[model samples]
Target: MLQDTTSSAPLRSLLFHLSDVELLTRSARQIVEEEAPPCYTLLIFTNGTGRLYIDNQPFLFSPDHCYLLSPGTSLQIENGTDTVVCFYRITFTVIQARDQQQVLYTEDIFPNRYELRVYPLSRLIRLTEQLYAGRLGKGDMEWFKQHLHFQELIGFLLEHNLHSDPSLSLTQSVENTIHYLNHNFMDSITVKQLVQLANVPHWQYTSIFQELTGKKPLDYLTELRINRSKEWLAISNAPLRDIAHRVGFADEYYFNRRFRQTTGVTPRQYAISMRQRVLVKDWTGHEVHIPLQPLRIIYYGETIGDLVTLGIHPIGGNIPNPENRLYKDPTTIIHDVGFPFNTERASALEPDLIIFANSDERQYEQISKIAPTITYNSWATLEERMHILGDWFGKKREAEQWLVHHHNKTKTMWQQLQSSINAGETASVFTYDHGERLFVMGVTGFSTALYHPLGFRPVSKIQDILDAGQGYKEIQESSLPQYAGDRIFMLLPENKISRRAAEDMMNSTLWQSLPAVQSGHVYMAEEAKWNFGDAFTRDKLLEMLPELLQGF
Candidate 1:
C-alpha cells in the first residue's frame, strides 16, 4: 500500500518517523528487507572508496555525499579499487495527508532517491553520529529522542538541496590538490599539506583523494619524486645524494629505498639495463637507432600484452587505465608513462627505447626527445605488430614462433567454437563509456578477436565501420536492434556512470526483448580485461571466448 503512485497536492500534515539507524562497517554488508525492513533509507558515507550498488546499479561512493535510497531498494557494497567502505544507514518514513482531512496526499516527501552534496557536511555527519550513538541505548525514550534528530536531518537535506551551487566543493578542492601535487612533486609535501590545500577535514580529504587518484596523498607524492629521480639518475651523472635532494628526498638512503620499493629494481640495476644500438626505420618512417637489446624499455601503446606474451617484459610502459592491465599479474613492474605519454616521466626512466603506438607527429616529436622513440601503428593485425616488434627489438625468430603458435591455436579455437555456434550467426560488441553514450565496436577491440572467417559474422552497420577503418562509433539506442547481431556482447567499463547505464539497460524490457537476450546469447565483459584491440588481448580473448560463448 505504501509503494503506490504519488501525486502532488496540498499537504496539511506529515507523519515522519525514524524506523532504524545503524553504522555499516563491513564491505559485504547489505540492507535488504529481511535483514532490516527497507524504508526511505539515507546512506551517509563518512569514509569509503568502495563501489555502492543499489538493486544492481553501480555507484562510486564518496565521503560526505549522502544518498537517499527508496523503499525496498537492494543495497550492496562491493570492493572498489581501494579502501574499506563505511557509511551510516538511516531509515525513515514520511507520508503526507491532503487538506488535514487524513486523506493520503502522497508518499513523495522529497525526491524518491538521489545523491545530495552540500557544503559543510560536518553538520550532517555530526547529527548522524548523534543519532547512531543514541540508537545504542535500550528504551522507547531513546527512540523518541532519535526521532527528533531525524526530523532535523530531513529538514537540513530538503533545505540544502535547493542551493544549486556552493562556493566551495570538496571534490573540486581535492582535484585542485591533485594538480598541485603533480606540478610540485619536486617540493617537500605531506598529507597534512595536501589536506590544508584541499581545505577539508583530514579524514574526508583522504577518502576523496583516494577515490579521485586511486592513491594515498603521501604515496602519490613519493611516486612522483621517485619517477623524477629515475630520470635524473639516467641522464645525469649526479651523486645519489644530489639526485635525492633534487627530487625532494631528504636523504640518499631514503630515496634509494623508496625507488627500489616502487620500481621493483634498485636505481643502479635499472640504469645498467639501458645500452647498445640498432638502427631501424619505424612504422611512422622515423629512422631511430634503438637499443641493440633493449632491456629497460618503455612501451607506450595498447599492444603491451604482445610484450607479455613474447617473454620480453618492459621495465616501464603507458597504461592509460591501470584497470586495463597488460596481464593478470598484479606485480608487473611496468611504470606508467601516462596517457598520451608524459614525456617528463618517460625521460625520467632513461629508457633505452620507447615503443610508442601513436601516429601523431606532434606527440611523436615530444616523446622522441626523451629516448630512441619508435612510433608504431596499433591498428595493424596481431601478426603485423609481432613482425614489426620482432625486427625492431631484434626478436625476429621469436616473432615468427609466436605468429605460428597464434595461427595454429586460433584455427583450432574457432574449430571448437563452430560446433556450438550456428553457421552465419553474427556477433557484435558495444559499451557505454563515462555516461549514456553507446559505442559499437567495429574492426577494433573485441570485434577483431570475434570476427574470424570461421567464427561470427559482423552486423551490417558494424561491418560498414570495419570497412571505414574506425575503431568504434556512437549510435542512438533506437538503432540497437539493427546493430545488434545474433550474439550480443556488452563490454562494461570501470566508469561508474557507464556501468550503471549498462546495468539499467540490461534490466530494461527493451533489452530483455532483444532476440539475443531471449535466446540467452547475450554476454558481458569487463572493458579492462577484454576491450583492448591489441594482439595480446586478442590472444587472451581466444582462451576466454570459448568459455564465454558456450557458457562453460
Candidate 2:
C-alpha cells in the first residue's frame, strides 16, 4: 500500500489504500465461512440480526455495529432472521508510516485480538452506501473527498476508544476542549475559559491543543464564529448587527474588522458576494439566477432521473410512476409536488432552486418568487442536460465520467449483441395507444444505445420521419410493413385506454404480416425501463440489450 501524499489528512492517507468496498445481503438461516482475511475488513450493518464467532467466542450483532476484522483472523457469521440482513463490508490494507509506526498501530486501535468494535452508524451508513454505489469514487478528486470521509470515520472511532491508546492520552483532553468551543462558540468564550474547562495549565493546554488542531485556541474560536456567520450571510437577509451578535461578536464594528481579516473582504461585502446568484441561460433561453449549491431543490420536470444519477434526492420534486423501477422510490422518499406542480406545496418546501420542463410560461412568475427557477427542454440531448446539471451541482467531473462510462458500456453491448444478431439488421421502437405511435430513436435517451455505432439501425421509412424533425411520428397500422424493421421493440402502454388500443393492433392481421412479428423479432419492452432516457436507464439498457438480442 502506498502513502496518500495527495491528501493532508492523516487518517485519509491511511484509508487511501483500500482493496475493495461492497454491500452484502444475507438471507435467513444463511451460514457463511471465513478464512484469514488478507486485509482489515470493516463491516457496518444497518439492518438485521446476526451472530459472529471468532476463536469460538460468539458476539451478538445487530444494526449499527462497525465490526473490525484484523488481518489473519478467521470468523463465521450466521443470520438468524426471517428477513434479509444487509450490511456494508469494506476491506482495506492499513499502511504503517515509516516514521510514526506508533500512530494507528494495529494493536493500539484493536486492543484485543479479533476485536469486533461497535460504532454508531448515523452518518457512516450513508458514506458506505455512497462508496458502494459508484457515486463517490468517479475520479481522483472525488476519491480524495471520500478519503476525507473515511478519515473522519477513523477519527470518530479513535475519539470513542482513546482510553486504550496511551500515546493519545493528551488528545482526549484536547477533544474535550474542542467540543466545548464548538458548543459555546456563539457565546463570549475565551482561551482561559476553555483551558479552565479542560482542567489543565494554560501553557500546557495551549500547546497540546495547537499540536492537535494546528490553531491557537482563540484563533480556532474566531474561525468557528466567522464560518457560522458566513452561512447566515449566504442564506439569510438578516442585518449585520444581528448576524454579528448571533455569532458572539458584541460589536458590529469589531465583527466587520475580524471578518475582513479572515476572509479578505468586509462583512457587508462578504454577505453580498456570498449570496450573489449565478446566472445560467436555460434551454428555454430564460436567464435564471440560481443560488450556489442549493440544498433544497424542487424538480418539476420531465423526470427526476437526472437528479438521482447525480446522487441528489431533491427536498421536493415531481415523481414518475410508483412502478418505475428506474426511480428507487417514487412514492416514499420523494415529496410529490403534483404534476401541474402545486405552487403552494412547492412554496411550502422552500426550495432554493426550482427546475422544470415545458411548464406554462404564466406560472414562471409565481414559481420564481418561491425560488430561482430554471427550465429545460425535455427533448434536448442527454449530454446537454447533464452538462447544465453538472454545472448546477458542481459535479462536472462526475458527469463527464458517467458519459465516458456510458459510452463504453454502449459500445461493449453493441459488440456483444452484434455477435448474436444479423449484420445490418434494423430495429424500430414505438407504442400502440389510440393508434400506432412510431418513434425514431434519436441521439439522446433510448436512441443513444439503440442507434449507437454498431447498434441497430432504423428502417428507411422511420429514418425519413426522423429526418423530417417529427421526433416520434404517429403512423397507421397499414404502414407497418414499410416502417417496421427487421427487429422491433413495442413499448407496452400503462393506461387502460392505450392497453386496449395496443391489444387491437396485436390482433390485427396487418400486424402479423410484418417481418419482425412473423419472425418473432418484435419484443415487448418494459415501459418503465424504456420511457425516459436518463443515465440510470441507459446503463440498465446496456445490461438488458444483449439478452434481448440473443436468438434474434
Which candidate achieves the best lDDT against the true structure?
A: 1
Tens digits of per-residue lDDT for model 1 on 243-333? Answer: 8998899998998899999988888876665444668998879898876766567888777887777777776776545434354332234
Clashes of 1: 1
Per-residue alpha-carbon lDDT of model 2 for 1-552, expressed as tens digits? 001122222443353356677656676679888676767778776555556776465554555556677776677888754435667778776765656453332432344423333244434554564355332244688577566656656666555553343323344445556755654578888788776665566887889898877999988888988976876776677788999999999988999999999999987787677565777887667887887656567887655677778887676776544324443321113456777779988887657788877647888777888888998766666787788789877789988988888778777777866666777888887775443453444334455457655877877886776576444666776776777888877776655567566667777898888878988887665453466677677776676666556621
In order, candidate lDDTs are 0.71, 0.66
* Residue pairs with backbone overlap in model 1: 231-348
Predicted candidate 1: what Cα RMSD to the true structure?
16.3
TM accuracy, model 1: 0.53
Where model 2 places Cα greater than 4 Å from the true spot, the runs are 1-276, 326-332, 434-445, 468-470
- Lowest summed lDDT across 10 adjacent residues in model 1 is found at 1-10
